[model samples]
Target: MALNSGNGTVPDSKLGDEHVAVQKLQPDAKIYDRLMTLSGFFKQQYGDEPEFYVRVPGRVNIIGEHVDYCGYSVLPMAVEQSIILAVGTNKQRAQLELHHLDEGKFQSFDCDLSDLEIKLPKTGGPGWYSYFLCGIKGIQEELNDKWRPIGMRIALSGNVPLAAGLSSSSALVSAAVLATGHAQGMPLDRKQLASISASCEQYIGTHSGGMDQAIAYLAKQGCAQHIEFHPKLKGTPVTLPAGSCFVVANSLVQKRKAASSDYNERVVECRLATRWLAKSQKLPNWKDLIRFVDLQEACHLDNDAYVKLIDQQLKKSIYTREDICEGLGITEQELETDFLTPSTQHMQQFKLRQRALHVIQEAGRVVKFRQICEQLQRRSSKQDIEQLGQLMQESHHSLRELYECSHPDLERLVALSAKQGVSARVTGAGWGGCIVAMCDSVKAASDYVNVLKREYYAQLPAHLLERYQPNDFNEVVFATFPSNGAELFVQ
Candidate 1:
C-alpha cells in the first residue's frame, strides 16, 4: 500500500506488490550524484543492489529556542542538508549490517535485530550506532504483533554537520526508523513516525521535545512551519517574506547534548519552576504539573498574563535545593528521583526566575514571530520585515542572557551578523551551534557571508582555516529555504 501524500505530509511512496518499480533520482537534482555514489558503495559492500533508500532532512530553527519542551510553538524549516540510507533486506538472517560512507570515521557494526541494546556512555555521549538502534527499536515496538527480525545491509551518507545543533542526530534516527519500517513492509504515517522517533531518542539520553522529528516528517518545499506542541502536533506552513532569505553559519564548536547535563539541567529547572508557579496559583494537583504551558492553561491566562505570573510567583532569582524541597513539601530524595532527570540529579541551585522568565517570554516571541510572518505574507514592506528581524534579535538576547544557552562563539557570530544588519540567533539547543540569520535579499546574503568569512573564519586556527577554501565555504555558511520532508524510495 502506498503512503498518503498530503500538503504537509511526508512523501513516502511504497513499492508495488510485484516489487518491479525502480525509484530514480532526478538527473538535475543537487543530491543525485551523491545518491548514485552511495548506491555504488552499497553494491560493493553488500555484494548486491539495495532494495530502497530513505532521505531525512535536518532543520534550522528560525526563531524559537529552548521553548518547545515548555510546550510552545517553534518556527523552523528543513535545510538542504540531509541523511540518506541505502538498504537491502535479507529475509533469511536476523542480523543488521550497518556501514557508513566515511569508513575511517564510523566503523561498520553488525547486531542481532531481535535483541537490541542501547548502552549509554558512563561519561560523555553514546556511540553513533546507538542512534540507529534507537530508530530500529522504535519501529519494532510499533510493530510488536507482526514483528519479525530480518537481516539488512545498510549504507549511510550525510552532509549534515554532527553536533552543531542542526538536528543531524534526530534526522539519522528518523531515517533509521523509516528504513526499518519500510523493510518490514509495515504501514507508516508521518505523524506516527515523528512521535515514535521523538520518544525513542530518549534511549540515547536527551530529554527532547518533538520539534526536530516533527519538522523532519512534515516539512514542505519553500515554506517554514509553525509547529505547535501543547494542543497537538500540527504544522502550519508559513510563507516567508518575498525578498528575505535565511543563512546558516556554524560556530565550529560542537555540543553533544547527551554528553553533558547542561541541556537536561535546563529541562529539570523548567519542570521545577512550573510546579512552583502552579502551587503559587493554588491550582489543584499542582505537583503533577511539569510544563509551563500546562500551568498557563490551568490558570486560564494568556502569554502576557503568564509572564506576569512568573514575576509574581517565582520571586527569587535563584532557588536552592533546600528551598525547592521546602516549597513543594517533598524530601530531597523525591525531588531527585521524581523531579530531576538522572543526569541533573546532583546537588545544585536552580535559576527558577531566569529560566521561567526566558521560557514565558520566548513563548510569546514565537507567537509574535509567526504573526509577523503572516503579516508579511499579506503586505511585504521594509518596516514590517525589520520588525521580524528585531524579534529575532530579541530572541538571541534572551537566549544569551536569560536562557544561558548561548556560547561565546555563538555570541560572536550573532555580533558579527548584527554588524552586517542581519538578525540572527542560536538555532538549536544552543551552547555552540549554527546561527540562522535573516538577510534582505540574495545579494545581501552574499555580502553577509563574505563579511563572516573575513571577520570570523579568518580568525580560526591555522589548521581549521586551511581545511576551508576561500571560494567554497558553503558548508560553513550558506543561504537556505525550506525543503521537502522525509521521503522513501523503492528500487
Candidate 2:
C-alpha cells in the first residue's frame, strides 16, 4: 500500500532506444486503493506477495472506427480507467494461475506453461482469462521455441467496463504481454508489444484492427493519439482543442463481439468492396488489393477520388455469391475461401456499398479530426472545435446508417446527447457498447453528466437498477481525461 515500497523497473531491452518506462509509483489515492485491494487478493490466492504490477489503460476512440484493418489512421485517447495486474513468478512446476478480483463474474483458470491454449465457447466469446492467454501465446510464438516463458501467478483488477466500446479486453491482453515479456526479460518496445497484442486477439476470434492495442501502449498523458497502421505502427500525439472534454456513457447493453460474426462480416465486406472496385476499374492487381487505402494509392486517387470511385462502382444493395463470382472471375468455392472468414462463411448477401462507404468516409473524418485538433493547438477557436464536433456527428451517422453497427441503445444515448447540444458517437466495434460525447468545457461535461443520470441511467432495467448507488456513479457515465499507457510497478 505504501507508495515507496521499492524500486520498479522497465524490462531489459537491447534492441530499442525506448521501451515502456518504469518508474516509482506516484501518490494517487484512487490508484493506490485499486492496487492495494489487488495486492491483498494476490496474497490471499497465491500465498505470496507480488513481484510487480502491470497497468494498461483502456481507450475511447475519438473518431474513426472499423477502418484500421483497411490500413487507415484512427484518433483515440487513453482513459484513466485501466486493467491492473499484480504479477509474481511461479517457479513451482511451471504453472500459470489467474485470479480475478470479481470472483462471482470471472472464475479462476490455471494450466501448465507448456500447455497454454485458449478454449473459446461454442456460442459466446471465451472468458476474461482467454485474452490473457492470447497475449502470452503471442510472445511465445514470437520466440518460436527458442525460449520458454517462466511460470506466473496473476491477480487482475479492472475498472474498464466490460463489453463496452472501451478497449477493456485489449488492455488486458496488452498487460499480459507486458507482464510475460518483461518477466522473461524480452526486449520488446511499446510498438512491438502493440503489434503483437493486436495480432494475437485473432486467437479469440475477433479481428481487431490494431487501434485499440496501439493506443494501449503508445498513449501519452495529456493528448489524443493519431494512430497510423498503413505505413507502419506509429502514434503521433495530437493536442485536444482547448476547453474540450470527452465524456463516456455506457448504454448497459453488452454484446461479446466474438459471440457473433458482425465484426468480422464488416471486415469481409470491405475486402469484397475493395476487390470489386479494383476489378471494375480494370486494375491489373485487383485480386491482391483488399484494403481501400492501398487501392487509393494504386489508382493514384486521393481520399475524395477513391470515395467517388466507390460511389460509382459499388452500387449494390446485396451482391450475391454468383454476382460477385462472375464479376471477379472466381468460383463460389474460391470466393468463400478467399474473401470470407470462418465465422462469416454463412453469408449470402453482402452490403458492399454501405460498409465500404462508412470506412472510406470515416477514415477521412479521422484525418479532418486530427487536422482540426492541430489547428486548435496553434490557435484556440470555438469554431474549429465545433467543426470537430460536426465531424464526430457525421462519423456516428455513418456508423449507424452505412456501417449498421449502431444499436438502438446507442441511438437513444445519441438522441439524448443531441437534446443536450452535444456531439456523440459509438466508440468501439459498436454492435452494443458505450457512446462517447464531446463537451466544450468541464462545466458543460458536468451538466451533461447530471442530465444523463436523471434521464438515462436512472431508468435502467431492474437488474442494474438495484445495484445503483448515487455516489458511485462513475461506472455508468464519466468525464475521462487522457492518461499514460502501460507501465510496470515493482516492489
Candidate 3:
C-alpha cells in the first residue's frame, strides 16, 4: 500500500498494529502551525512549498541504560519533543538539499543522492549532515538497485535538546530515512524502518543497539514500550503506574557520542567480555559471538545463572589490552580491526568484569521493571511500587560504578532527585546527559520540578538562566508521558 499520497488522509492499512495511530493535519492546530512555519521557511529557501512533513520523536530510557547494545530488553518512552522536517521532492534533480531551521547552528548542505559520502573527522565529530547522509544511504542500500534516488528540498526543526542523552541525533536520522523513503515511494514498515535507521547510524561510527530507532518508530501514546531485541524487534506497550510519572532533566553537559570514544569504548568492553565468557564455556562458534545476549542464549542460562557465570568467569575488575588479546588468542591488529569500533581502537584497557556484570544485571533489571509494570496493572501496592523505584536506583548505581558511564553532573542530579524522594537514573548513553526520575504523584512531580529548577537550573550562569522564562522552566525539566511514534503529514 502507498504509505502516503497527495491527499491529507493516511490509510490505516498502511500502518499495521506495530505502528501508532496516524493523524490528519489541521492548519489551525499547534502541530500544523509549526509545520506550516517550516513549510514557509522551505518555500522561502527553495522557491516551492513542501509536499509533506515527517516527525520522529526523541526518547528517554526510563529504567534500562546502556544495556540495549548488549542485546537486551529496554523500557523507554517517546518524548513529545522531536525532529520535524518539511520536505518537497524534486523529480528532475538528483541532489538532496538540506536546510536547518537554526541556520546559525548548522550550515546548509547539498549533496548528490546517487553518490552519498559520509566522512568522519580525524578528531572530534562528523558534520551534522553526515547523519542525514547515513539515513539516505541506508534507504538507498535497503532498496538495493531498484532505488531511483530522488532529489529533495528539506527544512528541519527540532526541540529535542542536542547531545543531552536524548536520542536527538537518532531521531534526525530516522526522520531523514522516512523523508527519503517517502520521496522514493518505498514501503513504510515501522520495524523495517527502525532496523534500517539503526544500521544506518553505524555509518557515522556509533554502534547504537536499535533502542533509539525502535522507540522512535514503535512507540505508542499513553504507555512506555518494553522493547525486546534479539530474535526480532518487538515492542509491548507498558502502562506506567497511575500515581507515578517520569520527569527528564538535562544536566546541560553535552555528550555527543560521535565526538568522544567513551560510549563505543564501553560497547567494546562488553563485546570482549561476552567473547571471554563464551570462550570459557567452550561454546562452538564462540569466536563469532559478540553480544552478551547471544552468549547468554548459547549458555541456555537464566538471569540468575548468567549472574553466576559473571562471578565465576569474569573474575578481574579490569582486563588490559594485552590480557584480552592473549585470552582471545588474537593479534592486536586482528582485535583492532575485527572487534573494536573505529572510535575505540585507541583504547588500551578494558573493564571486562565490571562492564559484563552491568550488562547481565541491568538486563535482569529491565525484565523486573516490565514485570512490575505488568503487576501494577493487576494490583497496585505501595511495596510493589517501591520495589520498582529501588530497581531504578540500583540501575543508576550500577551505571555509575559498574559501567563507569555516569558523569559528576548527572550524579549530582541523581543525588538531588534522591533527596526529593524520586528514584532517578542517568538516561541515554550517559557520560553527560539527562536523568530520568520517577515520582509518585502529580503533586510530587510538580514539587520535584520546582526543587530542581531552584537548585539546578538556578545555579547556572546568568546568561543561561535568562534564556528560560519563569513559565518555560518545564521545557528543561518536566514530566513526560509516552508519545506517538513517527508519522508523515501529507498535504
Candidate 4:
C-alpha cells in the first residue's frame, strides 16, 4: 500500500514534471495506485505482471466544427485533459485482457487480428470504450501479413467527458494504438497511426472525417492546427494574435443520442448533396470537385440543407429563372441540360444553404485569419486582435444562422460573451456543447465567469456544475500553423 512502490522501485513522489507543474504534483501516485489496484486484480485472476502504461489527450474544436467530413478546413487544439492507460502485456496466448478505472471490471478477449469481425454480446457496451477496441481492429487490418503476436492488460483514467463532442474516445484509441505499436516494436509513422485510428473510429459506425486522429497523432505543446483534409492530409499552424488566449468552457450537457440525430443526419444530407453536385458539375463524382460544398452549390441546391433540416419553403426557394440564367450565365434551354434533371435528383435536402456558405467562406477565412494573426505578430498591434474577435463573432453568427449548430445554451453563452464585449462562439459540432470565448480583458473574463456561475450553471442539477472557471484575462495561445500528428512517447 506504500505510494510509489510498484515493481520494487520507489519513484520520487516530487520528481515528475506533472507534479511540479500542477502544484500538488505526484507522478508516482497515479502510477502506484493504478499498479497496486491492477496488480491485485490480475493476481486474483491471471497471476501475472502487467506491462507499460499509456496516455493521450482529448481535443476541442476551436473553430470549424462539423466541416471536417465536408472536405473543408478545421481548427482544433488538443486539450490538457487526457486518457491515461496502463497495459499489462501477456503474450502467452492469443488473448487480450482489459480493465477500466471507474468500472473496476475486467474483460478478456481472444487476440484474433485476422478475422477483424466483432462478436458483441450487446451492440453498445458501457461508454466509448468499445470504439477504442474498434481502433485496434483497424490497426490489425493495416498489418496484413505482418500482424504481431500480443495480449494486453489496460487500466484507464482521464477527465475528458464522454459524449461531449470532444475527441475523448479517439484519444483513448490513439493511446492504445501507440502503446500496442510500441510494445510490439512495430514501425508505424504518425500518418499511419492516424489513418489506422481513423479507420477504426469508422468501424464504430460514426464515419468521422479524420481530423481528430490527425490532430491526436500530430499535436505538440502550445499551438493549434489548421488541417486540410482530402486527397492528401496536410496541416498548417494557426497563428493566433499575440496576447490572446484559447479559453474553452464545457457546457456539461451531453448531447442525447436520440435528440442528436440532427448531427449525423446532416452528414448524410451533405453526402447526397455531393452526389447532386457531381452530376451538376459535369464531373464523374463529387469527389472529383476537391470541395464538397462547392459541388453542392453548383447543383443549385441551398447549402444549409447539409448542416440542418431545410424547410419546404427553403427547398422551393430559389433564384428566379432569369436570375438562374444570369447567375450561371445560361439560358433556360441550356439550363435544362446544365441545371435540371442531371441523372442525380430526388435527393433528401437538409436546410443547409446558409450552413454550406458559411463552411465554404469560413474555410477561406481560416487562411486570412492566419495571415492576420501573423501580421499582428510582426507588428504587435491590438487592432488585429479586435479584428480577430470580430471574425470569431462572425463565425459564430454564421454557425448559428447558417450552420445551425448553435443551441440555446450556446446562444446564452454567446450573449454573455457579447455583454462582456468579448468574442465567443459555439466551439464544437454545436447543437449542444461548450463555447470558446476570447476575453477582451482579464477582468472581463473573470467577471463573466462570475455571472455564469451566479446565474446559469449554479442552479443546475447537483451533479452538473462548472468543470473549471475562466480567469479575468485571456491567455494568449500561439496557434501557429500545422504541426505533427498523434505520436508515441517512449523512454
Candidate 5:
C-alpha cells in the first residue's frame, strides 16, 4: 500500500483538513487489500462510497511498565498492525451504523445518533461497538453550540490482536473520534483527541493510564514517543539506538483489563498507598493527592528519597481494611467511598508498599531508558546495549515480583528470551499479554523469534497447536518498528 500524502505522509488515510493531510491509498499490493475490502464492505453495507477513512495503529511499549496511570512518562512506539475504518456521513436516517469483519466475535450494531448511550455489561468485556460509541459520544459532548452531531455509516476491519495488550480497543475509540470529528468538520487536535479518547474510554469501565490513547494520536514514524501526563499532556519523540530492533511476542494468554477487577485493584492500591503516606507525613491536603506523582511532589522528596520514605513509612507488606482505617483515622465506609472504585470495593488486603515501589522505580526506569537512547543518538556499542537491556530486565522483574502483574506464560517467554541473549519484559497492563524484547539487530530478532517458536509456541497442547501453526510465525511473534499514528484518507 502506498499513501499519496503531502506533509509527513503515510501509506494510508484520507482527509482534506488543515491539521491532517489528505491522501489516497492506492491498491498496488496485498498490503492494500484490507483497505479495499473495507471500501467494498462500506458500499455493500451503506449503499454509498465512504467520504473518508481513519487508520489508527496499535502500540508496543518498549520499557515502561504499569506506570502511566501514576502520572509518569512512558516510552511507546506505534506498530504496523492497525485498525482501519471506511466512514461516510449517514443520510438515510439519524442512526450510526457500525460493522465489524469478525462476525464470530462481534455482531453488527445500529443506534440512533440523536440519543447515544453506551450500554456496558455487568461482567466481562462489553460489546465491540460499545467502544466505538464512546468515541462518538465524546466528540458529541465536546462540540460547541454551532454544530449538531450527525450520524455516520462506518465499516471497520482491524488486524491488531484483541485483548493482547496492543490497545486494539483504544484504537477503535480513537478512530471513531477522528472519523466523527472529521465528519462534523471539527478542527481536530491530536492532543485533545488523545485526552478525550482517554476520558471517554472510562464508559467501558477501566481506569487506564492514557499511554495507549496518547500514542495512538501522537506517534510519528521511525521513533518512539516519551509521553508525559503531569504539568500537561505532551509527547517527545526519541530515537532508538542504531542497529536495534525490538520484537514483540505474544504469550497467548489473554486477560481483558476491563473484564477483571485485578487492574482496578492495582489502581486503588496505588491511590490508597499515596493517601496513606501523605496523611502519615502530615500533608495538609492528603486527600487531594491521590496519585503517587502528586504525593512525591507534596513530600518534596527526590525519586531516591521518596523510595526511602516509602520504605520507612509503609512498613507493613499488607494492610487490612481495619489497619488502613485506624491509621488514617477514617471509618470503613469512608475508605470504601473515598479510596476504592466500584469495581474494587471488595474487602481485601492492600500491598501499598509493593505497588508504590513499582510505580516509583518503574518511573525512574522510563526516564533512564529515554536518556540512554538519547545519549546513544544513532550510535551503538556493547555497553550501550547492556545499559538499555538491563533496564528492561529489571522492569520485568519488578512487574512480576513487586507489581504482581506478570503471568506465567509471559515469564516463560522472558525466560526463553534470556537464553537467546535478549532482554524481554511484560509490556502492557501485564496480567498475561505480550512481552517486548530488545534485540541487538534485525538478524538477532529473527533468531530470537525462531528460538521462541521452538521452545515456547511449539510446545503448546494439541488444542492450541491447531490455532497457531509453524507457518504462522508472524501472527505469534514479529518485529515492529515505529509507524505513523492516526491518519485520515479521503476517497
Candidate 6:
C-alpha cells in the first residue's frame, strides 16, 4: 500500500510551497490498495487520468484550546498527518464521489449549484457527510456561473486521529474542497479554499474560529505559523531554532464531547458568552471587544485604566449561568451533565478557569515566541530558548489547571519530558489526547521515551493494556518543521 511513497522521508523540495513531506499517520496496505482501486475506478468511470495527490493535514493546537471561537489568535501547526485524496476531474456531470477505503463503500452526491438542499452522508455519522458537501457547496455558491458542476472521485486515506481534537473532520472537508475546486478548474487560492472550508464546516455545528482550516490549507514545511484571525487572516511562519525536536504523544483516552453527542453545546455556550459580552458593552459585535494591546497594557486587568475600561464593558453584559444555559439551548441539569463537566464537577470548573486564562495569556505568548524565534533566525547572539520553554511550561500549566484539557496521561508524559529537561504542553483540545513537547535535544527526547516506556506503559487502563499491550517507549514520535499543505496528483 504505497499510498504515500515517500513516507518518513523528507523531500528536499518541501521547504516553502504547497508540498507536504509528512509520514502517513496510518499507512495501511489494505486501505491504500482500496483507495488506489477506487482511483482507478474513477479513471475508468470518467475517462480522465488521476491528477496529483492532494493531502490536507490535521492540526494540533499547541497552546490554545477553545480560544479560537473567542476571536483570539492561536498557536497551532499542521501535524505530519493528513487526509489524502487522490482526485481526478470529469467534464460530464456536476457530481462528486467519495470512495471510502476503510469500509469499502462509495458515497457521492450530484452537484446542483442551485440546490443547497442536496445532502451527503457524513462518514463518521449523521451530518458528517453534509459537512464535506458544504465545503464544495460553499465554493460553488461563491463561483456562481463561472464554476460548472464537474464530476470527481476522491479516495480518502490518512492517519490523523478522529474525534481527538486533531481536526480530522476539518481536514476531510478542506481536502474535498481542494479536490472539487481543482476538478472544477476554479481560481480558488489556498486562503480562499481554507475560508470556504471553514465557513462550510461550521455548518457541521461547531462555531470554530477558522484556525484548523487555515493551518491545514496554508501550512508550509519546516515552519510553524503564528496566526491572528481578528483584524484579518494574517500569519507568518516562525522557524524553529536548531537542535530542537518536537515530541507528540497520544494519551489514548477518547472523550465523549469530541463526537456528535455534546461538543456542539460547548460551542454554543462560548458564542452566547461573546454575544452577551457584546451587548453589555454596547458593541455591534463581539469582534469589537478583541483588542491587540501592547505588553504593558495587558499586564493588569483590575487596576490598569485600560483594563478597567474593557472590564467595565464586559461586566455590563455578563449573563447569569441560567441565561447562558438558555441561550445555548440546554437546561441547567443538561449543562451540568453534558456541558459544564465531562470529567467531574471539580475538574469542569477548573477547566473553565483554565480555558479563560489560557486565551488571555497565550494571546500574549504568541507575540513573544515569534519575536524570540525571529531573533534566533537572524543573529545567533542571545538566544532565548529558555524564554520559549518557560512560556510553553506556563501554557501547559494553564492548559492543565485553567484550560482543563490535560489528562493524567498527558500530565505524566509532560512530567516525564520535564524530568528529561524538555518543555511540553497538551496539543489540540486535550482531555486525553496528544501532547506536544519541545525537547532540548533529540537525545533528550530519546531519553524521555526510554524512561516513559519503563514507567508509563504499566499505568494504562486494564482494558487498553489487555487489548493493546504497551510496548516500552514504542509509540513516541519526534519531528521537526517545514511541512506542506494539500497537493494534486495525476497518474
Model 4 spans with C-alpha error above 4 angstroms: 1-50, 104-116, 119-127, 256-260, 284-349, 440-444, 465-491
Estimate, for each residue in 1-491, the C-alpha lDDT of model 6 and write its tens digit.
33343432223344334333333433343234534665676565556665656677888766555556565667677777778777765577555666555544335444443355644334344344565676777777777778775666655566676656677778888887877776667754677787788787545545557888888877766778887776567667877777777767667766523244234443444434444344444444333333323222333332244334434433423345665555445677865665443323322211222233445566667667778888987865334988888888988887676555577778887887788777888776667767777776778767765566567765677876774454442443445344566654433
Tens digit per residue, CA lDDT, model 3, 115-205: 7888888888889989899999999999998898578899999999899988999999999988888888887789989999999998988
Per-residue CA lDDT of candidate 1, range 223-324, in tens? 999999978888899998888889999999999998989999999899999999989888889988999899888889898898888888788878999999
Clashing pairs in 2: none
Best candidate per TM-score, number?
3
What lDDT would candidate 3 get against the real structure? 0.87
Model 6 worst lDDT window (10 residues): 343-352
In the range 1-491, model 5's lDDT, one tens digit per residue, is: 54444333353233332245555555552236777789988898878898887899999999777788888899999998999999878555678888887767789999998888888888778888988989988888788564465778889999887788888889999999899888888777888889888888888888888999999999988899999999789999999988899999988888888789888899888888988889989998998887888987777878899899899889999999999999889999998898888888895899999999999999999999998888798555678769899999999999999999989899899989998889989988889889999898899999998988888988988877887785565787999999888887764
TM-score of each: 0.95, 0.95, 0.96, 0.73, 0.95, 0.74
Model 5 whole-model lDDT (C-alpha atoms): 0.85
Model 3 weakest lDDT span, ten residues long: 2-11
Worst 10 residues of 4 by lDDT: 16-25
Native-to-model Cα distance after best TM-score fit, residue 468 in candidate 3, in Å: 3.2
**Global lDDT scores for all candidate models:** 0.86, 0.87, 0.87, 0.58, 0.85, 0.61
- Candidate 5: TM-score? 0.95
Off by over 4 Å in 3: 1-14, 19-23, 28-30, 469-472
Query: Against the hidden true structure, what lDDT does model 2 obtain?
Result: 0.87
> What TM-score would candidate 6 get against the native?
0.74
